[model samples]
Target chain A: MPNDTLLETRPVPGTDKTTAVAVRTHALSKEFGGRLVLHSLDFRVEPGELVAVVGKSGCGKSTLLRLICGLEKPSSGWVEVGGERLSGLSRHARLMFQDAALLPWKSVKANVVLAAPRNGRRDRAAEDALEHVGLRDRAHEWPSILSGGQRQRVALARALASDADLLLFDEPLGALDALTRLEMQALIERLWLERRFSAILVTHDVEEAVALADRILLMDGGRVTFETVVALERPRDRASAEFTSLKEAILERILGRRS
Target chain B: MATESLSYRSRLINLAGPWLVPLGLLIAWQIFSGSGLIPRRILPSPLEVMQAGFHLTLTGEMPMHLWESFQRAIVGLMIGGSIGFVFGLLNGLVGPANVLFDSSLQMLRNIPHLAMIPLVILWFGIGEPAKLFLIEIGVFFPMYVNTIHGIRSTDPKLIEMGRIYGLSPWQLLITVVLPSALPSVLVGLRYALGIMWVTLIVAETIACTNGIGYMTMNAREFLQTDIVLVGILLYALLGKLADTITRALEAWLLRWNPAYR
Candidate 1:
């Protein structure tokens, strides 16, 4: 356990002390009205591992994200982040929603500042995050006035601005147009390289998982059916035969596996 | 400047929309009365009503009556709306609290609030309190329902985001819940305000000595159709004024909403 190992790694960023494990889940099970959603789900996300979760519709991938993020309580397991229990202490991570969940009453800057400190450093952080997301110019505008892509950028900024070491993305770019989606995916990859944080991305797109994840967890019938690790280099060619073969392999595994 | 000109034209059209029916009715009424198609006493000329309206405003009597009714309605609205807002917030944020009051309150809300007139007067006498109570009852329910609906209707995903960000419950309420609930709450308030004015007339007619409602009642007794017409016009004016203010305030508060954009 990372919880026991946290003391060994000192001088933790954003904390005076250090933590062993960034995130740990043990036999995490979730059910709704006796219908099994997630069963005996045990997973460990390293301090800065970027994992993509791919699954068919209604396969409990989003539910796993929710459980990890503490949005929904687990039926019979524990989720700990950076050596702290999640149930009592609302985990200080951030989630980027498909809807961009920006409070419609606040300006872009205010929305970004919502999770930041209330001082000079916080202001600088928010400004830097917006700049990083390419929304610095739209910081003062209402979210309602922004384009769909711009709004998603702001939502991404809000998540990235959080001091937490973990980020749970629940199909944050599923609603974007194709052209914008490419730009966003590249930007997200760039951001991930710059900011080393554990990210668990829940998405339906096989290509998205292959393109972004260091390791992809393929879930079927509320269980991890296959675990795939991309050995391809960074900025990997999407059209390369190797990439196509990998995608095909994952697809076959997805199609072949039956509950 | 280009967009502004187009917007100005649209603004004029919007303003003119509501007046079309009233303006046509006015022309029809004037022609009917002037041509003796309808008896003067029966239809009453628009000119006569206008004259009466002018006289009532120019003199202190009608103004005083309007002020009295306005005062009663506003006071009841303030009290009733405050109660409704508190209950609504409680019902929204606290599950057990909502369960405690929701069903019983819902049952009580079904009774005709207007029919409480005799009982209100019996308990509180013919004083201002009785009339105010009646109007307050009218204002409470709509505001309460809207409050609960607004609060409960908040997006769970956003709320989860707040929690994941380590937001305290109070922080959650102020940041996420209030903004989400605002549109509904404002709508409820507008409905409550309109009903307050309506209930004022009923209460005033039953008990009060001087008000717009009392003025209309007095005019009916004296067979002065012109005065009655003036009172009705004043009621319409006040109701429209209240609605316009609420609409403007809603625009100001929810400026970030895409519907407004």
Candidate 2:
């Protein structure tokens, strides 16, 4: 399998030295009212690796992210993050939803600062995060006044302000327009490159998965049906022949065609 | 620049428009009363009411009555509002509290607060306590109901987000729950203000020897229609003033809401 080869070849830059594995799930399964949603799914992500999980609707991709983030419990098996079992929300992980999910009552700065660690430098950290998202000018504005893209940027700022090692994204850009989605994907990729945090992105868009993730895992009937390591270079060109071939390969796997 | 000036003019017109009807009514009443169509004793002219208001003010009687009434309203509002806010928050957050108190409180709310005046008067006598008690009841239900509604209506998604962010229970309450509930709580406060004035008037009319209600009643006994009209006008003005202040507070507090803009 290419998995072992990719792991051996890929250099994980900025990974914390003390913890080599960022997330690990062992035979994780979840059942909702006697119906299996996720079935004994075993997965591993190295520190600083941006992994994308893709599947059709109701294929348990989101459930997996929720499980890893400690938002939901597995019916069987368990999840480990940073070598510790996740019982509830751990300070080491942060999940960003599809909706910006900014608290409408708070200003952009406050929303970000609220999630930050209660150190004296929280305000400064929030400001820096907002600056990174190109939203320092709109820090005082309410989320209600922001456009969808701006709100999402603020949400990004909130996530960035937090010192979480593992970032879980549940279709974080699924609501945006085509142009905005592309911009957000680039922004996410840039941030992931800079921060080098371990990330698990659950997305419906295969192109998005190929563009941002270092590795892509496909779920089918509640199992990890396919996985591929995208060993392509950074800032990958979508129009390039190599990028198209990799995307097509993943799509074929999802469609159950071996062409 | 031209459009900006035009919009500013339109805004000014909008501000002035609401007063036109009341001003017109006042002018018409002044002319009709001066023309002697209605007996002066029964419906005093607007000018006469203003004169009475001025005379009462000059003698300090108006201020005394106004001060007394304001003190009672404020004291009762503070006492009842705090209790209602606490209870509402508790019941909304705790399932057991809701199960224990919500239905019973809702039942109590249906019984008109004014209906308890007779029992209240007997229990507390016609002292300040009775008036305060009546006003408290008037203010409590709206605050309590709105507080509960506000707390219950907080977005579940926001709560989930808060939890995932590793917020403590207290932080979640302060950051997410309270702000979401504030708009509803403010609505309740406005309603309670309205009820407070109504209850005050009734209590003063029925028993009290002080306050604007007392002044109005005392004026009626002496057939000083002008003074009675003055007292009524004062109540209207005070009520409007309270409403305006509350609305301003709501605007300031909920400035984050796009709907408000």
lDDT of each: 0.84, 0.89
DockQ of every candidate: 0.58, 0.69
TM-score of chain A of each: 0.89, 0.90
In terms of lDDT, the poorest run of 10 residues in model 2 chain B is: B252-261
What are the runs in model 2 whose C-alpha is more than 4 Å off?
Answer: A1-21, A255-259, B1-9
For candidate 1, the iRMS in Å is 1.9
Q: How well is candidate 1 docked (DockQ)?
A: 0.58
lDDT of 2 by residue, A17-134 (tens): 2122489999999999999999998999999899999988889988898899888988999999999987876667788888888899999999999887785478987898898889
Q: Write the per-residue lDDT of candidate 1 for residues B168-257, one digit (tens) a residue.
A: 899999999998999999999998998898788888788568999999999989999899988998999999999989999998898888
Estimate the TM-score for candidate 2: 0.93
RMSD of each: 4.4, 4.0
Interface RMSD for all numbered candidates: 1.9, 1.1
lDDT of 2 by residue, B206-235 (tens): 978789999999999999999999888889
Alpha carbon deviation, residue A256, candidate 2 (Å): 4.9
